[model samples]
Target: MSDQPPRDSHVYDGPVGGWGSAKGIAAVARTARPGPGAFDTLRRQNKPGGMMCSSCAWAKPPNPHIVEFCENGAKATLWDLTSARCGPDFFASHSVSELSGWSEYDLELAGRLTHPLRYDAETDRYVAVDWDTAFAAIGQELQALDPKMVAFYASGKAGLEASFLYALYARAYGHVNLPDSSNMCHETTSVALKTVIGTPVGTCVFEDFDHCDMILHVGQNPGTNSPRMLHPLQQAANRGCCIVAINPLREKGLLEFANPQSPWQMTLGAPTEIADRYLQVRAGGDIAALTGIAKQVLALDRTQGGVLDHAFLDAHAHGLQDWMDWVDACDWAELEQVSGLTRDAMEAIGAIYARAKAVIGVYGMGLTQHVHGSDAVGALVNLLLLRGNIGRKGAGISPVRGHSNVQGQRTVGITEKPELVPNDALRDLFGIAPPMDEGWNTTAFVQALLDGKAQGFVGLGGNLARAVPDTDRVAAAWGRMPLTVHVATRLNRTHLMPGRSSWILPCLVRAEVDMQDGVNQQVTVEDSFSHIHGSIGKRSPASPHLMSETAIVARLAAATLPASAKMPWDHWARDYARIRALIEVVYPDDFHDFEARMNQPGGFYRGNPARNRDWQTDSGKAQFTRPAALDATGLGVGPGLYRLITLRSNDQFNTTVYGLSDRLRGIEGDRMLIMMSPDDMAAEGLVAERRIALTGAADDGIGRRVAGLRVIPYDLPRGCIAGYFPELNPLSPLSRCDLASDTPATKGIPVRLDLT
Candidate 1:
């Protein structure tokens, strides 16, 4: 038995909503001066068949209310339409060296990018350059380099239209090096879900929350990462749904949520109590916990005939008896040892699952950002498959995504590994030969850059330098590149870490009203549940010079490719509907009747055959897998060593830091802090507020270490510690990654911590 950590000084004890959410929305709304009211902007966001909120991928309402966005959604919306402006004059005064020293928070606060800038070697400054000249310069470098040397990356910031064009452009250049942020976040979900369900996306829709009797949330803090999700979670709880939370930290939002949207919650009624049973498990131990639950469920099914849907299993699934036998053979002692969860607790949750007619298992990267990330996903699916939860009214497995359109980008061809090469239809449509060879993913691209095999790079969105593991290492490789281009809405750390020749091309954000050729245009984005809808900006552009992502890709494509390699690049850029029409041709089954659906109430679903129990897998039925997590133990991590997992603050979204204060966790004025269990802290001779250093446990030839991290003791699993990412990303070596997805196993970092 180990002693729990002391109460954190900064741990927020306040209820989720009440005045907190109201103040947050008001504060964010005020930042966007010279813009419309926050309520007005929110109204436009929910307008019938209008632009989707840029903040998160949570499902929006079909027939929405006047204020359709959550507090975080409001923050993301207003931040993009901020009154503060950053133009060429500001850059003229600030040298690249000076800007390099600024923090990510301060850099974004400097405001939206105003002009296209190119690095001037003589002055070490980014001076504004005309779009054509910048395009031509980059084109010449790409022409000089081998096709394999060019690495084109996309991000959630780029909508479906831009993503499709970027993927098309890269392949037209004779390669498929189109690695995006999906490779870093939910790539494991994409791979694992497809393996079992024959589709890469979730089988359930937002409506599932309403009908579900129980929700088994594992390894996710929806309060911070996906705050919007808290709305439905609270609503579900209010409706008497039993919610069970399995996480390292008992987050405030999961404990007590105050929905500002609900009048009863805002005024006098008690705040919606979220978790009926909150189980704290060791980080990366979710798979073991899940396995234990499945063991209990299997036992209940064998003795209690109706517990498992035997009919559904016999009709639609295979390999169940083998999986059940494997579960029965598991040792309870090892399950508790690995998961840090008691057998009694596991059985209690299993009993809940057995009794409930409908159950939904919702999870996040806490399970997928580990060494056995893919296996963890499969394990969750296995739990769902046991009771025939898929294709049901209120039952499914959801790997909740963080970004706005990371999934949508993948749907629209922002992938290096394309299953379909240019068939006769593709070749005839584009008049270009699609590359046959598979391309590099994020991990492959990183290794390629370090090995000096990759030369040219084009980033559609995202801060690649800071976002990737080993920030300094990635930045070094990026600087050595012959040419690099960033098409973005605002300034970021990656923009400052430039190549020998780099261009910063400003683009319109989701908040900005985009009018091409005097005609108003709208772009489409797919939510986490695979619902595609139109997004049209209500506010004016942050800068008049800023172009749309579609326009930027179109120009870049026109400049790089020879005229013989033909496509309707210019025409599609002028009218995005043309691009949608092309999407219809490319993916007819999904994007068919794209325009009419975009105009309809809410949006139409991108049909998933697996949702109807139509297994597209090679086996003819859903396959259950036994995860490798059973072997996961901090084996050699004894005295001074620990397994560290990186986290994001409630104040930030992905790599975009809105503020330094993490209001949800009650931390302020710093980001270099680590949360540890009391027993682990005492063992390391660490005291409260003491600064510490973290060194990579494994000697992978990359001596990764980070200093100046402050200690904060909290109730956490023993031998496990947590720290904020992008800051702690340096300590997490690139070698620590899942072999299945190449996603850096940031959550499964083995490290040795000591006083700084």
Candidate 2:
């Protein structure tokens, strides 16, 4: 049966949750067929002190209810723990060239990888290899090459135990060339948060959601990407908390939702309306809108008595006047032109902010995946700072993280940069001098591989070849590496793009029990809100031969590094408690008594210094950042071109394609379609459902283009078009990036739709 969606281009008009979400969850289960005990996987998954959702990084509340998982969480678990198995026979049946033709959705659906497979270039097929032989070969390659010649690609899916080991192994091997998933998605959030707030993470915890009087959601569709968030939002709405949604599309999740988990709501069909005010901002116009709002608020403070928190501004913030001056200097016409909103509309938004005593600003990739993404994030923070919204209950900046453990992984050392974590502490802990040299991020790592400067590459979890921008270039670059190793559960496009010698090391998924030396091990993972919780998978492994990510890291370390002898690699690998013990020593104040807290009722919250009002910024106070003018970043759709932003289909997560349909937007049975404004479509004489090509207008050295995409009329800005990524990834300019964070400007692609 085809798991592809229906061929109707009808949008889902039902409430966000309720029966629609139930059907989605049930459909995912039937498609995944993750064995008979799949029900158990759903029950144990994200069950408070159980294994957290292996999906998005939206943190679980401190005291989670019995049924804590959402539809997305259920889908993720089902996908990971699917019953389908890909073993030696499956590899023998399909050649690398032939398998490359299969869709990403089909490849992952073929099931969990059951063995370590080495690519046989002669036959263009992968053959099984023993763990020892594969480990030794990889070790020999590492031993032969200089550490600088290698790049370590890490992501957030791995548990904290495994990620810590991966970082420890990389440092022990004498280099810090670790590029990770954060570089692609939330890196700008980190850079901006650190620069102004003195913390490189979201200041608000799940607790803040309970107390916030109002919520301003910008550039995020939580209905699809983070369905679990609907729980808190629905609760907040029920409690009379006002919400404003700012985005190009009118997302149904933000409009109304009926919690699937709530029996009364589900049965009665009584849905809670979410967004009190919906503001449709133009693509990449978030900063412009933010500036206008700030300007209006300043005006309101002048006219209305005591609107701005003067005491908070004077005592806890710096550069207030300069920021206010910049806001005042912004021209109303320019702001209106850029934001695509009238002055009155902007003031109304400002009025909401001015009225609220405590407000929370939540944003996602929509705010951070642009050329001026860092500036946009800083501007959002400035709005919060103006009213002392941050570092207090019910108010703060929350950049909704994408990956499950991306933030936590960074907390435990999955970074490409240097000196972020103190080197002396690492050296003293492991008796190994950590490499101090700045390393490559995702963008630099790709370039280095293309330049043939890197000899080997190791991916901890993510599908790097498909996930990165410039798909063709990345795939070609993958073939140039001398050795490439992937620690993964499912087969993907990246696994097929092998070098001279490539190893696909099969690893256990999050929903499977990881047995270490006869002990069922539970690993820790950090959530978006900086809460660290234990994750213990209860289901059996897809394959008996599968190795835990922790074991893989340990074996790789033991084979490659002599310092592995000094470190308790064997003990730590056998029992994850040892890993926690080591982590506690490294981050004493945060992870104190780490092992003891694993089984607690609710996971420990690693307090954010910024949230506690302790500003450790360079200025010793919260810095009021002045966002640049609308045209400051030099961003544009080009002459006769449109701004193309990549979006995630309701069925997909990152690069993983759950299905071929996006029910939210009504497109079905296809992923290769672009949503355009009707006016833009008419201007270009392009009819709806007509197939066309999109050419990149970026001046980057490399040529970028994608062909055979259907255009559909949608409610969006005139100069903006929307397409799905990994498909549209080729159109993303490799050179055009957020300058401050080195993140690819994925959400701001300059493109021209071609009909001829």
Best by lDDT: 2
Off by over 4 Å in 1: 1-10, 29-34, 37-39, 420-424, 564-566, 631-637
TM-scores of the models, in the order given = 0.97, 0.97
Candidate 1 RMSD to the correct structure? 2.1
Error of 1 at 597 (Å): 0.4
Clash counts for the predictions, in order? 2, 0
Give one digit per residue, the lDDT tens place, for model 2 in 1-756.
Answer: 001222332356778878877788788888888787767767766665467888998876666766778777888888887878999999998999999999899998898899999999988999998999999999988898888878888878898899988998888898888899999989998899999989999998888888998999999999889988998898899898989888877777888898776789889657898988887888888888988898889999999868899999999999999888888888999898888888888898899899998899999988888888889898899999989999999999998888898988999888877778767888777788887889888888888877788788999988988888888888878888888899998899998889888999999887778888887888888888888888888888988889999999999998898754469787789989889888888888888989888666456887899998899899999998876546323475456877888989888899998877677676787888898877777888887889999988877667777898988877777788899988999888778788789888888788877777
Q: Would you give me the overall lDDT of model 2? A: 0.85
- Encode model 1's per-residue lDDT on 184-226: one tens digit a residue: 9788888888888898888888888889999989888887777
